[model samples]
Target: MARGCLLAGARLVDPAAGRDGAFDVRIAGDRVAEVAPSLDPAGAGVVDCRGLVLAPGFVDLHTHLREPGREDEETVESGSRAAALGGYTAVCAMANSEPVADSGAVVEQVWTLGRAAGLVDVFPVGAITVGLAGRALAELGEMAGSAARVGFFSDDGRCLQDSGLMRRALEYARVFDAIVANHAEDSALAEGWQMNEGEVSSVLGLAGLPAEAEEVIVARDLALARLTGARLHVPHVSTAGTVELIRVAKRRGVRVTAEATPHHLTLTEEAARGYDPVFKVAPPLRAREDVEALRAGLADGTIDCVATDHAPHAPEEKDREWDAAPCGMLGLETALAVLLTELVPGHLALARLVEAMSAAPARARALADHGGPVAAGRPANLVVFDPEALWTVDAAGLASRSRNTPFGGRELRGKVVHTIHDGRFTVRDGRVADGKG
Candidate 1:
């Protein structure tokens, strides 16, 4: 094998280091050996990165790999491939699987599967509730000490409704400095809801999920986080009210962080107008004003990062009537394109976008080796992309096993040209590398 690789002549955009200029980065082993204005290729394999932006690889704090049970929808290998293709070098796998990743064995299984994939680094999120049952706590300490070393816990598919239980969970997580991410929806208020509660839902005559449903839970969680002083993460912040709550909580010194999804930032409840099941999601799409608030929150630092909820389902499960279909849509492959096409330059600066998608998320998840500043001695976890490249989304061309992307058939800009993880090219020339070269 080549001793190292040389990425030549790329505009390095490392938000963590506040760098945005032309530079050549040399990789030796799995670390960046050098970074300069120019470097000779020597014996290293050279990739011409002219006209591309080389930045730290993206990180997703909320991705559903659906392994150990729902392999028909997605597996660690397939999901890692999709993440690499989308410029991500690391992703936090959600605990909501068929058997539920509530124990050390399960989380380790997921972690091992990710390593075997040899694409992105996968960190398994342990379940906060046993079997996501909401009644009892899972093996948080065990999972944390396990081989996966899970530092994030959540019952993403279901909210832990018992206030006492949630407080106890927060207190327990504080001992390990782990993050407890909540889905932030009250089952009572969002019960049987089909879409966001608004004019569109009123017109469509479908049951509505009110914004207050999310805001109430967030308020409660914020209070609990303040009481326990534990690290709390709110996943997929969707509503304007929730954004305001998070903003105020941060101002009050609560240990809280929030994330917004690409779909939630760009799409609104109006996408459900045609009753397309693909648009159905938990904490369902909110109003246009809510979308604006989410973007502003991300740009202004109230929202910490952008995470692709990246849920995938089988065709039979997602192609049914809106009310009958399951929530979630494919996101791993299209998150960057969607954000670049919809928010960059207009609503957010490119540096801020890079921070949200890469550095910020890695910081939130505490993945020290993933996000970067392209300095010597840093891990070679990086992505190179053409900011001006445009392409049309096609479900068949995606690496995910499901065909449930809402952006299918839509044109998007900023295609990923290459993705490197641990000094190996996982994606090259806009295609997944076979590792043979």
Candidate 2:
């Protein structure tokens, strides 16, 4: 529970070092002091990690903890609990909160609440536009100077479509050494679209969200990134063409990174055929071919990271008719399981999974404290998981404040057993610790 060496004995998989073996990891006072075979279990808290896979704690580049303004939906506390249960040690809380994390004061407030929550590290992201209005650039430098150390600026859940505004924002954010994270949807092209436009939408009589809506924005943003010579990160990129665009940009030496959500890699537009809003997400799930392409991208390193995009909504809001309901699904709690069950077995290896979930996001968000080789003196944020454990997802029993999981009742392989955050046992044996640290 406190300062001590913890011998986590499972299949230790530190993808950053390409180390995978049945080893022991020792943590001393919030830092990994040793990681090797058979450390003496003498005077340490030997957490029996039998049948588990010990790895670095996950880092999410995209998460919507709708606090400050929409506590009715979620708060930093509830969302942090969800993150802990999901084996995450840190998450980049999005800027699209109630008052919006545009100014330094609001962003600092969000950081304070996250620290108080004491579950996982919540890095506050600053808004790309004031009030997320897409009109004027937010105070990027002020936010970066705040306690939050804001490194990501976004107009997420909405695109910063005003080309001039976007250019200026990229230029301004560069001054703070921050990146502009775009939602990448053309408002005019994606208006009123509920789910991915395709044969399924036509069959269900639902409005379709054409892939071009996302593709067009991604193309424009890449061009802007090249022009401004500023770093850009495209969040929740769901289409194959978008991945190709990012690949080309990287080849051209544009400082850009892109992330794909678990839903985009596993589920498809076919899931929306039943008119279930749970399957509704921004950049709605695409076709099976798109999912395959994304998996290929992850395997080949074309896609940089796998973010949760963990959006939570209250039951009342999510239970409405498909078109009337808010978009998003509970992902933090189920992302790893979905990956292991849906992707790893056939398409990707466990090492690739760890990289996508941890190192890549850490690099993308510039959180140097996270994602690493389990070496001496590194921060002791780690996760021990039972890769062989199979379980069914229960939305009602989740740690999240809201039950909007689309994978409810779905059987999945692999599960997290113990999550160590900053050397604290936030979750032990698949349960959260009793008190807030």
Candidate 3:
């Protein structure tokens, strides 16, 4: 399975290059040696992929593989398997570990674990602040020069609200072209907030987190980014005002990019009516009008990409009452299918889907080896799937250690049949291949 592979008759959709056509892609060793029609197998393992779509391996800018502390919830091994099964070749691991990846040694430990897992390339993100306390800055220079070569930094579970601190971090990151990713919530405004601030929270008798809690921070960060001329990435955009802010920022030449999770695009405040903890996420889902704005933002290229903030929590932790449970959901396994079911045919095209899920994330995170056209000399990280296949999600069947998927038991269309990572099959026939490299 580590040898080269021949993917024949699949429609290649490479949004990065704007190419789409039926082709046979031949991978030799760790590079794409050739791509054309009716190529000779040449002793390679051949896969019949007719009626399937071959695209670049997906890149996730936001993922929480809770290793180094919360192994019972998720580890590098378990989360990498889940990502591979979901057709991802690379994932940016957040620095919110117990010890926090604020230094070279800690970040390298996470990177080494990813290499040992042999499922996906895990790039460790350094912390923007020491211990994510939003007080002092972390060892950005040390991490950037570490073996991990960390290019992204964040205090994702928290925000860098001190305008002076944020300005310094962005100014420092600007030197290396590293991005400062923000979780985008004003802590004081969102204090004790349970869900979206509207009729739903009033009726449910829960404290509301007003939409301004998120919008105000985004607006502030965009202005800071303009001042520093630094690349800023906003994660989990959930409000109409936030989208408009990003739209305006980009229009006015402010360097900013944003991601919308699968749940935000598909769910609404009504899902929280039943007090289901699974629907509770950071920057809680918004009302229908906000959802429509998100969709439009994505469609019109205002929102750059779709990132699975694939946060996993232990059963005991997630099964609690609504207010006590953590705010997140399992997303890597269901993101694409959920988007296909929610946006295709009416709102989005297949090419746009590839762009948002693959190309844009790679560009946003500066992952050079991922999100490319199927061509000679490129890294052979690719995914092949039956775009028309239908399936259902069973939480127990997922590859992650935690069963916290919000889409459990829901029927979904579009199935990933095979995933080729680094010129080999990590997933074949809709199942994981040998995990040991």
Candidate 4:
């Protein structure tokens, strides 16, 4: 796609530079050319961002793009479109794809398809263990050398239970400067679980996935990180105890960081009281106290980022009974709105939100061209959002291949109006733009 010009008029928020202002931003050749109170509208395409808030495009640290297999659920093309529509310029596509991205060949294939999609920068996260079985480590070094430049590895939806194997994986990954991300669930304790192990699950007669299931794994991972002096990241940590554990570990200088999902930050397991599969997710949502603690942690800078955990499922897959249904919810489009309406209103600043959504995730994933200060030399990945714009989420209207969003019919306060990836408007006027290339 050829690049030209764009003047995004709204509150420009760039967390990396600590900048916030109502400025007109100009783009030229896939990089931010100038940002000021006013730019010469000389022959440039003018975009009326009257009520929008322009910021660096979001970067999701965790996303499940079920491709290479399970294309019926989601493919790189469809998932990339979903990311673009959700205001993400980049997303770390989980390695649990079809055929499992456990080798260099598979990883490179995913990377190529993602680029061809031309909607988002999809970084392929390599599996921590081959087949994500938690028994043997995958070819981390080889995958890291592939086109994807894999830096993050995870066994998401499965726990790395063997301490020796995990230690070895971490030790080996460090050689290539890769970080190991754990799903943080003790399979032994969480066996037969469906929702959060609490009063809600008990009341609903659903098998409870205990909080200790997460806490124990978190505590163990921190110890391993401390021992190996290797970088570790915990994904979608849902319990308050896990938050305090990470806080203390960071205090003690353990090389550990953690992320919380939007659902965990806002909705509790109580939202699953009706056995709605939309709320079903791995590391199921927890109690209200946990939600408050997660909010406090994000506000206080203990939690490193807020990831979507954007797991997509076909309608038939999620339409089953609670126990028979698959875990996960569509998150890309609803994440920002949930953050704006639920977090910002309670003292979380817009800058903090940007950090959690973009800057931090970029740093965590080690992506060179994303997250942003929006300078003259950086890649022009940006999003124009109408922060005050109110709209109802109609799952039927989303760009993802699936309509499993938990926010269906809910009125959200913020909406993404335009998303530019590599200087091309992948999403314009709140709709997915056809591929420019």
Q: Number of backbone collisions per candidate, in order?
A: 0, 2, 0, 0
What lDDT is reached at residue 284 by model 4?
A: 90
Estimate, for each residue in 280-381, the C-alpha lDDT of model 3 and write its tens digit. Answer: 889898999999999999999999999999999998999999999998888888888898888986888888888888889999989889998768999999
lDDT of each residue in 116-214, candidate 1, tens digit only: 998999999999999999999998999999999999999998888989989999999999899999998898997799999989999999999999999
lDDT of 2 by residue, 1-437 (tens): 57676665678888777788888888889888888888887788788776788888999989999989888778999899999999999999999998999999999999999999988999998998999998888888899998898989998988888989898988988887788888988989977898888898888888888889989988998999999999999889898888888888899999998888988999999888777788888889998888888999889888988999999998898989898899888889899999999887699998889989988888887887788777888998888887778999998898888888999999999888888888888888788884642
Q: What is the C-alpha lDDT of each candidate?
A: 0.93, 0.88, 0.90, 0.87
Model 1 scores worst on lDDT over the 10 consecutive residues at 428-437
Candidate 4: residue 362 lDDT (0-100): 81
Error of 1 at 119 (Å): 0.4
What's the true lDDT of residue 183 in model 3?
86
How does each model score on TM-score? 0.98, 0.97, 0.98, 0.97
**RMSD list, candidates in order:** 1.2, 1.4, 1.3, 1.6
Which scores greater on TM-score, model 1 or model 2?
1
| Candidate number that wins on lDDT, 2 or 4 | 2
Query: How do the residues 15-113 of candidate 4 rate in per-residue lDDT, one tens digit apiece?
Result: 887788878888888888888888887888888886678888999989899998888888898889888888999998898886888999999998999
**By lDDT, who's the top model here?**
1
Model 3 ranges off by over 4 Å: 435-437
Residue 359 in model 3: shift from native, Å? 1.1
Clashing pairs in 4: none
